[model samples]
Target: MLALVLQELQKSKEPLSVAALSKKLNIDQSALEGMLDHWVRKKRLIENNAQGEMPANCAACSGHARSCHCSAQCPFIARMPKTYSIAAGERGTDND
Candidate 1:
């Protein structure tokens, strides 16, 4: 299962979401998360915040408001989920 996850990460050009991967790999998202965490510990995978950082000097941006910008009164916050990708120059082993 770990190997399969690694393979999927390797093939994807962009980071993948747990929900998408769960469907693709036929594994539960919770279980897949644990496996992804294992690879993160092994330094074979990296978790990234899909949402980019907010502007530094935005007076109202607390960086934790969960909204895109603090003062814009954005109708919806873009809640980007963490995505997983394989580490550069790392390869998965069949025995993993």
Candidate 2:
């Protein structure tokens, strides 16, 4: 089930909401939230504020809020590089 959800997220260009994901994948909301929270903690997924519920200054930028200048400078607007998950058995080479 996680694999299917990951695939859907990978195919999407924009951030997906929990409701949309749950409906599309036919999964329970609580279960999906738990999975998403796990990924967020693992740094495999990011949560974006949609309604300004969280203070803008408290937002994460590269895992730290201090790294960004926030409203005063707005220097943290650069796009983040795409992230991906690798299978557990994959071996790393020197080139990597």
Using lDDT, give the best candidate's number. 1
lDDT (0-100) at residue 5 of candidate 2? 68
The CA-based lDDT of model 1 is what?
Answer: 0.72
In model 2, state the lDDT of residue 56.
38
Q: What is candidate 2's lDDT per residue for 1-96, written digit by digit as tens?
A: 776767776656556777888888999989988887777666566665422433332434434543444645554555443233322222122213
> How do the residues 16-56 of candidate 1 rate in per-residue lDDT, one tens digit apiece?
87988899999998899899999999999977663346533
Q: Per-model C-alpha lDDT, please?
A: 0.72, 0.57
* Model 2: lowest-lDDT 10 consecutive positions: 86-95
Candidate 1, residue 30: CA error in Å?
A: 1.4
As a whole number from 0 to 100, the lDDT of residue 74 in candidate 1 is 50
Candidate 1 residue 87 Cα shift, in angstroms, is 1.0
